[model samples]
Target: MVEPGPSISILAGGVTALFAVFLTFYLRNQWQEIQSLRAIQTELEQNNERVRELAQLLTGDLQRQQIDLPIEVPPGTKLEIRYVVSFPSSLSTTAFDQLKHSGMFLRLSPETRRSLFELYDTIDRINRLRQHRERIHFDDIGNVHVVIDPSELDVEPDASVSEDDLSAETRRRLSDLREMRRAMKGVNRSILRLIASIASPEMIDDLELEPFLGTAHGREAGHESNTESPRSDEVDLEEMRSILRDVERESVWSRFM
Candidate 1:
């Protein structure tokens, strides 16, 4: 074969160098995309855990309310009602926001984009509801006194408080609690479904997010396995009453009184 000319050789070298530069940029973009996906996956896992904990607490309270059980206060306790609301950790949207604005995410299938947007929207709704519930508990209902007479101990306080005796504010508060529990259940289901969808083989492959998807799938499986047995809403009313009675005789209660 004849030797190539100098101009042709220089042109070939230029093309090779240009291709290398393009490849470097392409690889860098892919690396950043993977990092963002991983961060989003981690946040999703942490948020799911917080949702589970909140759901459990709400379930217990809802069960007690449904059964018309008293707040487990002893008779003549003269206790002050303190509404201590423990808020869950806020869900991080940093990675999700970044991905949504990125070109890579924009190139994703429209269906996938819609699904992601819906998931984030639902999370936003849950966060807003949580803040509203906290405001109702802390600002609206602050601290109320539960002045229990010694004679009232023989009968359940809930039983003694007639419908006519319940103030409008009390009724509103009860309604708010029930609504919050329902909202929480909805949020829990939505989150679980989102996790399952993102961890599916097709979605994982399309997103090129193997490791993050694997971790998410594992966490989802663990949660489902642990919850295989349905939790009974029923609680031991007598046991709760006894515990409260014991607390009444304790030095802490006496000091507060």
Candidate 2:
């Protein structure tokens, strides 16, 4: 039942106008902030896309033009590879025949070649040790060191009374060493075969490689010009092997234990 006074009405109208003005300013500020956030989000997405495009250029894709390598492997060492739906299990028998026939070993960068050679050397050493153990006579061999020669021992002459007794064992070790050498040669050939396979399209099945290749091959349009395809010579074999070893160990070995 209170009657409105003129001064009170005028004061109420002024307060109401001030509230509306404040509300309008607040809404405009919020809108501008939203617009700024949208622009920043758009820029980030564009940057991410640019990064992806650059990565694609480093690796090649099967659908795009392929580069031929100059390396030629000797005969009989070639592999016959086939697509295996279940890999790692089929890796042993299913020859990547296409890769072997392609002579892609010629495409191995110097780094990859070095890694392959090192792997071959390790295989050789391990095989030689195995062979030497197989050929030894139980009595003639002393220490279990598979490839050690008794004559090479720095021990004093008094350590052994007889020299002729070791001749047979020594000869056996020599035979083992020769056989090991041959087996190692075969292993080196096998590693070369693996490199040849990787150099070809078979490498796409590996993890991260597809994305890496996709980004490297420049398969898409409207991408920034910064993307560069990695030539065969540019790949760091050591780094690739380290990554592959980790992936294999994580995927293959961890399952059994």
Which one is best on lDDT?
A: 1
Q: What is the lDDT of residue 163 in candidate 1?
A: 30
- RMSD of model 2, in Å? 23.9
Error of 1 at 66 (Å): 10
lDDT of 1 by residue, 1-257 (tens): 65579879999999999999999887777666555544555666666566555544443433443313333344334323333446666555676798776655765557555655655654565565556556655555443333334343445544444333444665466555455444444334333333333233443354333332222345434553232211222112222223323433442323422
What's the CA RMSD of model 1 in angstroms?
19.2
Clashing pairs in 1: none
Per-candidate local distance difference test: 0.47, 0.35
lDDT at 227, model 1? 24
- After superposition, the stretches of candidate 2 with alpha carbons farther than 4 Å from their true spots are 1-4, 60-257
Candidate 2: residue 189 Cα off by (Å): 30
lDDT of 2 by residue, 104-127 (tens): 333445665465444333323323
Which RMSD values do the candidates have, in order?
19.2, 23.9
Report the C-alpha displacement of residue 94, candidate 1, in angstroms: 2.4
Off by over 4 Å in 1: 1-13, 64-82, 143-257
